[model samples]
Target chain A: MAKSIESLIPLSETAYYILLSLNVPRHGYGIIKYVEKLTGSRIKLGSGTVYTTLGKMSKVKVISVYQDRDRKTVYELTVEGSKLLELEINRIKIVYKDTLYQEGLFNEQK
Target chain B: MSKNKFRPFWSYDVLKTQDWLNDLSFKGYKLIKVNPVLRIFQFNKSESENKKHIINYDKGLDGYPIYIKDGNDYTEICYTKNFYFLEQISDEPNSVPSYNDLVSRNRKIKYIVGQMLLFQIMLYSFFILIVIIFTLGIGSVTVESIPSNEVEYTTIEIMSAIAFILVNFGYFIIQIWMIYSFFRLRVSNRKLEVFCGDGIDMSFTIPKDTILTKEEIRKLRKEKKLIKKTKVAWFYSPDKIEDWLEQMELKGFNLIRMSKIGNSFYFKTGLPRNVKYHVDFQTKKGANYFSLNKESGWKLYFTSYSRFMAISVWGQEYTELVPKYYSDHETKVKHAKKYMWTYLAVFLPAILFVVLSIGMSITLFAYANFENISTWMILSPLIMLVLVVELLFFCFKVIRYYSRVKATEL
Candidate 1:
């Protein structure tokens, strides 16, 4: 049976970034660096948050340890994670469409 | 060369210790090492400037720097059973803050302070129980009652009595001090408010959006005239405290005095200028921690076991400084969570102690039917009674403090 993405509708900012960064296989430090750079230094991942989040996502089959390099465990998103990410992105786009036409926002850019 | 000095600062005031260590550095004494348990820090004589020490805590760290991942080099100094203390030295004009994020830093500090409180309660009760047992067992056995044939018995009893007295006396002092620190933290957390009027005032708020020149600021200060106000407050939340103190200073109240055990601040009205406060939570620190902070512009004005509140006034260009305390939310939450772990650590030992004490009571009750109750055996039940009372008292304190700690969690 295909799992519905309804339960994962409201992903936390941390979880969302972790999943996005996991588009490529990366270890703990690698994921942290990727997230920081991806957000242009707006987001920084703590080791504790990364460790606990990976443990939780692994339990849900969203992410798994892809390989171990230099005694450091590397993690990658699974099929379930990719599906959830796609669904979340679509939901965000729907919200963006509803709000982009509002009075003051996006008017200056146009 | 000035001789090195050491002071015991174990209240988890990481920022204040850093400032103190920096002050020593400026005075020609350089901090070299720290011992957490002994609460002793070693220093060396050096003529260094623009030096600051950064301290970080992590539970499962093994010689790894959690923050300060830039060009700055760091060294692991000392650690307790479940924490690591790492230090970094910087000579740059403005040393980058170790913790730039406030939310995560608050969580980590709450966890550490919570755990420390729990451990303190356990230790206090254990000491109380020991004192009661020893006092009951051999405190008053008379030396005059010794028979001619049993001189050795008298000698043994006297020696045991002396040992019990010395141990209990030592533990009693530490237990009292620790309990006082706990109450101060708890009481301060509940009663913290901003005062601006004749009595304790809570409605005062700092005025914003006013850009005054140096002369205007001085004239305003002269008209208001400096007034001293003292208030007991808990700074369990680092993120809010910095803002609160900053606002107080913005209104011309400069913090001048802080109580050693209680969380009370003495604020004197001063010139309204650009000033900010940074609160850091650390375990005991040595001289080196202070030297690092002194080299920076921060002045260590307040201290508590879990709070190191410092104040600084730089120009508008440097007013947006972040605190260099805990680096991340994980570290912050880890310490607050330790508060719960402390209870877990005590659960088994506490259960065993209660069960054994109950069994001893039952045995003593049954033995009362056989013969004259042994004077020594009678003290066993007294010991049990003290343990139970101490446990009940500790539970009440834990409940009172746990609520305050939970309220401060981000």
Candidate 2:
């Protein structure tokens, strides 16, 4: 049975960035570079971290793996994975809104 | 002028050979050619400055040398089999070219080791067969069957036999020494892997510069009450061994170090704690493999020498929620299968050898008279029978572990 999308909720920072970068199929090194770029150099995923994360996500069917033309192992997010990403983005939006509202109140009180 | 030197077994210890070559270059003798078959080194005397020599085992894709063209600093001096002798003219030590792919380099070493082991096994089997034949000829003949006068061997024949035995004994000693050197090479290769990273990416090598002095080490050792224990053939069943180590930690024996070959484990007495142990097998590990695991707080205890199916022991202390090295069921099952197949491959040939010996002895007993059969012949097969049974048991344990992992959903 496929695991519920909710069970994989609260994706790790590494896992979230990895899934986000997997919009297009990418190999291990490619994903590392993509994640570094996507995060504006804030996150540089090590090859081992990418490899283990891809393995775990592949196990849960959140990501699918295939061999590219050059025989490199490439990964891309699955349909369930896209949905999980969307859910995470929505959750973040709520937190972002609350923080902004609190900042406005603090400014008014000052 | 060219000078020739004979070093019959130089390739067995490559690092030492490299150092020797470098030393020669410093003395103005430049390597011209290597006669691998004849075990000779040809050098030409030159007034050139000291140049660095790098011996690389070239494993190129599609049967070609990887470093075909000369780089900016280093040029190929000569080629012999898979080894390419490279020379750097620049005096700067840091500018000298070296292998960046440690995993590939170690794989080549593993290949050489495998070939040497195969040769040794063949030599040993032939030697044993000759010994068995001689013993049978001398011990099985009855006194009544012999002529009234004992048959005498010629002095030349006796002398030849003595020489042959001496040669074989010397060869046997050389083989033992070669085995020891191979172990030393493995230890050094693993150290290189850990300290130098792949050279392509960032390295997270544990600093060795902060090493404790002898007196400090002795003081620390006394305070910790360090103890050492040896366990042979631990790789045959690594999972059980990991559990055993973890259990020992719970009993206040925290594992501090493991010997180079992963046989001897050193521990220091400490408070009872929960520590998860993982036995990871990887065919090749990149710099990222070490960096990522280290970043995740897993302390690397031991890593086997061969990059081809290398085994590493990693441990992490936790108060709760046992950490999973492979958080997924698929990866865990795959790891178990790797253990099963590796042991199966290693033990299958051993089992066949044992079976063949037993079969040969049985046939010998059936064809020959009971009185003619020697006790030694019978004893040899009996010993092999016990060995085959033990090997089969180990195979069973590995298979069972694989099946258990396969059945488990997690």
Q: What is the lDDT of residue B110 in candidate 2?
A: 58
- What ranges in model 1 sit over 4 Å off? A1-9, A66-68, A98-110, B1-342, B345-349, B352-356, B359-363, B385-405
Candidate 2 lDDT, tens digit per residue, B1-410?
A: 99998987675556668889988888888899999899899999997656677665533211223222335555778887656677755444223222323335665665687578788899889999887887798865333666737888889998999999999999878778667666766665655443334442332232233234557657767886766789977777777788899999999998877776779887777788899898887765655466557655687887765655488788889987676676556557767887789879989998998899899988888898878888888898899999999999988887877887788674
> Looking at candidate 2, what is the lDDT of residue B50?
66
Q: What CAPRI grade goes to candidate 2?
A: incorrect
lDDT of 1 by residue, B123-205 (tens): 88999988888779878534466575855557889899999999999977866765655554443322211010101221111
In model 2, residue pairs whose N, Cα or C atoms come closer than 3 Å (at least 3 residues apart or on different chains), thus clashing, are none
User: What is the model-wide C-alpha lDDT for candidate 1?
Assistant: 0.52
TM-score of chain B of 2: 0.55
Best by lDDT: 2
TM of each candidate vs. truth: 0.34, 0.50
